[model samples]
Target: MAIDRATAALLGGALGDALGMPTQLLTPEEIDRTYGFVDRFVAPSDDHPVSRGLPAGAITDDTEQTLLLGRVLLESGAVFDHRRWVDALVSWEREVKARGSYDLLGPSTKRALDAINAGASPEDAGRGGDTNGAAMRIAPVGIVMPFEPLEALVAKVAETCSATHNTPIAIATASAVAAAVSCGVAGGNWREAVDCAEHAALRGANLGDGSARADVARLIRDARDLVRGRPEAEAIPLIVERIGTGVAAAESVPAAFAVLELAAGDPWRAAVVGANLGGDTDTIGAIAAGMAGACAGMASLPAGRIAELKGLDVEAVRLLAAELVAARFDRPDGRVAA
Candidate 1:
């Protein structure tokens, strides 16, 4: 039997995160030189900024923040109070700082936290960078809000993201990814979920923090067109050169979607494409592979790879998925889920 979509999505993201961890910041040239192809989960060979010295199969901030969002939703009964999220993140960062961890947090998060510490309101703290930090770990938002109307979902997304990535592109890209996950969890096919996501992206791109430079709508359009029928090898280089795979939501999110489209929703394949793309490998892999896993169903990932993922068992993820689904259905407008 297939694993539940929720379990699959979380585990798939964790798998991609671990697979791409070692190669996170390496140049495509360096990735080729160092590991050729990252086939299994491994720790960073060199100090790769965000995740140095992490054990093999250890997750990065991508999944950590994703879980944090989930925790907030569950604890708060599905009500999205931004201040609660702010407090939770402050505590999370405090712990991260206490651990003396490296490569664990992004620049945008660091800056936002600093501003908040300096007394900036939570609403205004996250207006600096427009990176994919918000998108990388936003799956939980989708999991919890799958049934909310699109406008409502988008509003929640805006609230969730504005704390650290209050830009149009970032929120839209993150919403698209989350919407895709929601559609998948609801039994939409990969194409169906992508379609849902594209629509959300269109609506989201129309609004923003007014400082973004990249036209996310155009980038996604070109990205989808560029790899519509291309193979992975051909798509990887082209995407790297044209679409890029860095911290920008416009770049990484679209790149992940293109890889998913090209790979036909194979979680592992999509992840490999993103991981091999060079920059922001972990985030790319996390988003693309997680979406692919959800849309393609749990069995879409390889059994071998699933077995190799550590610290994130399928059963545990499945249990959480059940809780989230129940919580989603349990909630009423502006009320906590049962």
Candidate 2:
């Protein structure tokens, strides 16, 4: 049986998040010294008390936040429901606080959610945030609304992102990611997906000098050119530096795309290449992995990488994926189409 698109996206994202958790901070050299290339997901570092060396398969805030947003979307069934989004954020904050999880909430998300709880307008809540939280949890939107009109999908992404990231660049990056994922789900070729993403991003925010969109686009083109005949090990470093692995959407998004483009046939390698890039590895890996996973499906993912996601809520990911597929492809007849 063919795996549904939504499940494919969710599982892909979760697996990437889990696999990159342990190597989130280490640079290529540090990762090599500490974990040595990280082919298989392993437990977190013993030095980090909070994570307490979380087992190999443990996921981080990336997956958790994405899943939470997916639930909100599934529950609401309407695009851009502010009340539902507020409730979801509140509930997520409470859950994380109750669990004593420190890193589960992004700074921008926390600030915006706090502002919303304090009676700030949703439009104003995220004005101070210029972070990538909006981009990180946006994959589900792509999965659910893949075939919707571009204007509608872009509007939904803007509405959702405005709660924690209203900056022009942030909005652009988020829209680009959602559009790219949607293109992938729609079975467009990689070049087509990238083109859609570029157009969507340009519509949302101009690609100014030093902007994330410009940087990511440059990286994508360069990586594609460099990887034509080079081995992954040689090409990955160049891509990472050009694109970066920082929290900025420009850095992370492009880096993720580079991994996907370079490792087109291997989802596992794509994710690891993202993780080993050092800063913000988990988010980068998560974003890249989501796209790669959607394009390649579960079968293309390595057994070792899938095995590493052991403790993650796989069933939840699967359920979210199924729901997104239903929302995107399934009509009343119970069949999926483009």
Candidate 3:
């Protein structure tokens, strides 16, 4: 049987994160030179201090922050508690800092959290930022809020994103990702899912300066036109070049969507293609992987690749995901009951 929606999100996010870890910083050419198209998970290099040359299966901030969001949501039950969300983020930062590790906190997130600690309102902490940090952590919200009305879900995502990515583009991008994942779970087609995300993003974009929105919108249009009847290899670079893969929400989110559009039914291939594209590989992999995982379910990911993800609370994530699905579907005793 296919994995449940929640388990699919957890495993999808974690596996994508772990797969992209080794190739995170390498340029596409360097990746080509070193690994010649990364088809399987590989160990980190000896020079890399993070994993100490550990074999494949090492997850990064993508999965870590995703789990943090899951934990917060599960604990908060059905309510969208802003203070609890802020507290959870701050508490996680403190705990990570105490351990002398900055593993889970993105640069933008760290800056926003620091500003929050230094007296900026949590709502204002990410005022000018526009990074993929918020988008990377958005999968759980999609899982939790799948059945809600689209506007309600978008509003909650914006609220969640405000803590560390309040810029219009960042908020829009994060909401789009969450909305796409949620739509996928609801059995939307690839085109329908992308359209739902585009709609959510356009709504957020309209509320701000709108330049980033225009850019992503144009890229999505162009990507759709370009990928018709083309192989993923022919289409990936065109979209990435036109849309970009930088950590900016505008750049990364659309590139992910393009890859998803091109590789609609194959989550593993889509993620691998995104990861090897270089330039924000992890974020690309995370975004694309989340969508594909939701659409295709966890079984779509290869058994070998799933075996390679490292350093995550796998069982906990699975349990939380199952609980979230249960809650959404009105099961007798999901995590909300406990």
Of 1 and 3, the candidate ranking higher by TM-score? 1
User: Distance (Å) between predicted and true CA of 147, model 3?
Assistant: 5.7
**If the candidates were sorted by their lDDT against the true structure, best first, what order would they fall in?**
1, 3, 2
Q: Once superposed on the true structure, which residue ranges of model 3 sit more than 4 Å away at CA? A: 1-3, 48-55, 98-104, 206-218, 330-338
* Model 2 whole-model lDDT (C-alpha atoms): 0.70
Poorest 10 consecutive residues by lDDT, candidate 3: 329-338
Query: For each candidate, C-alpha RMSD in Å?
Result: 2.3, 3.9, 3.4
Q: What's the TM for model 3?
A: 0.88
Models ranked on TM-score? 1, 3, 2
Model 2 lowest lDDT segment of ten: 207-216
C-alpha lDDT values of all predictions: 0.78, 0.70, 0.72
Evaluated against the true structure, the overall lDDT of model 1 is 0.78
Residue 148 deviation, candidate 1, in Å?
6.0
Q: List the residue pairs that clash in candidate 3.
A: 57-308, 57-309, 57-310, 58-310
Model 1 agreement with the true structure over 1-338: per-residue lDDT tens digits: 12378777887788788788878877889888877877677667755666666777777778778878877777765457778888988898888888677346877887898899899998788776588988888887777776347876666677788789887888888888888888888787778888878777777765557666555556767888899987777878888899888888888999988888887888887777777888898899999889888777777778777777655656666777777777766656523463
Candidate 2 per-residue lDDT, tens place, 127-147, comes to 756667888889887777753
Tens-place lDDT per residue, model 3, 98-117, is: 75557546778989889988
